[model samples]
Target: MSLTNKAERSLISHEEYEIVRLTHHPDIYDVAGEDLQATRKRLRDLQEKERTLAREKRRISRGKAEPRGGSFPGTQERPSQRKQVFAAAVKRLSREIDRRARIAARAPQAEIAERALAMRRENFNASHAAADTANEGMQVIASRRRRTTVHPGKVGRVSQRTKAAQARRDAKG
Candidate 1:
């Protein structure tokens, strides 16, 4: 994620936390549910789960970001503890993104082909057969429809007389 995205996400999370916090107010909880502490804990737990999932996704998607290598990455000294914490968090996210970008920049080769082959050998084999069967059913349905529907013979020349002739033939049948 971009720095802006991280900042925006944090702000939004703050807003959401506030909303959850407000829900615990005595007036609201009288109708909503009276377990203020439990509700807060539940919201906190959900937020933690979300963070954990995002962390895992970042790990999986690692090596996509363009790394800023002008100065030494980890050597940037932090004066304050809070700055150090934020810097570390940002560094981790940047590393994941940058790591992939570097690898992709090197040019694709046998590795990509191997991965594709591995995927081809996996769970989609059944689905491929299923798709063919579905298409066959659709084709038969389409053929049946074409045989039954009345179509203009000479390309948009369905005159009133022509329609009447077909209608009379239908009435007889």
Candidate 2:
């Protein structure tokens, strides 16, 4: 079955699907913006969704429910395969949730480090004011720009094979 059809017919709610979709994007954290509390809430919601998906997946995997025939809503996949689809969705969502949660957990520490650096800069500037005045008449030579180790041309280049591999990986996950 096609990927979009499978995802659309997953047992997860619309909001949960949207969250999972956003988490797959490269710039997901940027979409969350500068709000730490909002990030926390989003993480909470995702965690809850993950838990729910997991429960549903577990129930299906257990075979406690009777196997139903026919295609699921909005998909060509048979109802019998809904278990696999839910499992795949839960696994993908869980991986992304873990990654996002780790980044979100570190955000506060990053903010603290930034504030400490700012304070250090302020103190350094206050102490260096006199030195700055003493060197006011001196001619300053411009420093050479530092060359980076990474080549720009080699950055972010994904081969067609790699793209296909990723697509397969996503489908499986």
Identify the candidate with maximal TM-score.
Answer: 2
Candidate 1 lDDT over residue span 1-173, tens digit each = 33343343343445443434344225332522234445445545544544544454455459655434455423122213223223333343344445555776666766788887776565345344333454344211122344555565755565767999999999999
Candidate 1, residue 173: how far the Cα is off, in Å: 99
Report lDDT (CA) for all predictions: 0.45, 0.55
lDDT of 2 by residue, 95-124 (tens): 656777898899999999999888766555
User: Per-prediction count of colliding residue pairs?
Assistant: 9, 0
RMSD of each: 23.3, 19.4
Model 1 pairs whose backbones collide: 63-96, 63-99, 63-100, 63-101, 64-97, 64-100, 64-101, 65-97, 65-98
Regions of model 1 farther than 4 Å from truth = 1-34, 63-173
